[model samples]
Target: MNVAFFLIPKKDIVYLKEKSTMRQALERMEYHSYSAVPLIDNDGKYVGTITEGDLLWKLKNTPGLTFHNTEDIHLSEVEQHVQNLPVTIDAQIEDLISRAVVQNFVPVVDDQQTFIGIVRRREMIEYCSQLLLQRKVE
Candidate 1:
């Protein structure tokens, strides 16, 4: 099956811009209650994923960096420990499954490398379980 079958379109998801501030990343993640979120560039390309751990580490390691000063720090300054790889729009389900095993969501991109959407592991597992159930019923 096509990977698009499980995609949650970019329009429906919350992502941070490459130029966003560290404070912006924190507020967005906290408001959405997401542990991790995809990062996109101004050109709309997928950059990487940012996690809570990344933010925490940044604060812990950076001397004299307080929550108030986070606004002065760009999101780019924060190191992304987890590099969530992206797959093209035409990728197969097997490709998505392989990446999903290690990532919470597999970032999706187009031929131009523009950020498209993401496929969550939950949807993939549900689809696979349904397939297995159908086979058992047959």
Candidate 2:
């Protein structure tokens, strides 16, 4: 099956711009109640995934940095603790499943590495569950 079968299109997803501040990331994550969110470039390419842990580490490691000063910290300066590698839109279900094992959501990109959407783990589990049920019913 095509990877797009499990995609949650980018249009429906919340993402941060590459140049956005860490403060912006925190605010967006808070509003959406998501621990992690995808990072997109100015050209709309998938860059990486940023999580609450990354922010925490940044705050902990940066000397004299406070929440109030987060606005001055750009997303580019913060290292993503986890880089959930993106898969092409045409990737197979097997490939998606492998990546899903490590990521809550797998980033989906086009041939040119343009950000397109994501394949969530819950969706993959449900798809696998349905497949198994069908086999049993056969």
Off by over 4 Å in 1: none
Candidate 1 residue pairs that clash: none
Candidate 2 ranges beyond 4 A from true positions: none
**With candidate 1 superimposed using the best TM-score fit, by how many Å does residue 44's alpha carbon deviate from the native?**
0.5
Query: Per-residue alpha-carbon lDDT of model 1 for 34-106, expressed as tens digits?
Result: 9999999899999999999999999999999999999998887899999999999999999999998999999
Cα lDDT for residue 72, candidate 2? 98
Question: Model-by-model lDDT, in order?
Answer: 0.94, 0.93
Candidate 2 is scored at a TM of 0.97
For residue 34, what is the lDDT in candidate 1? 93
Candidate 1 lDDT score at position 38:
95
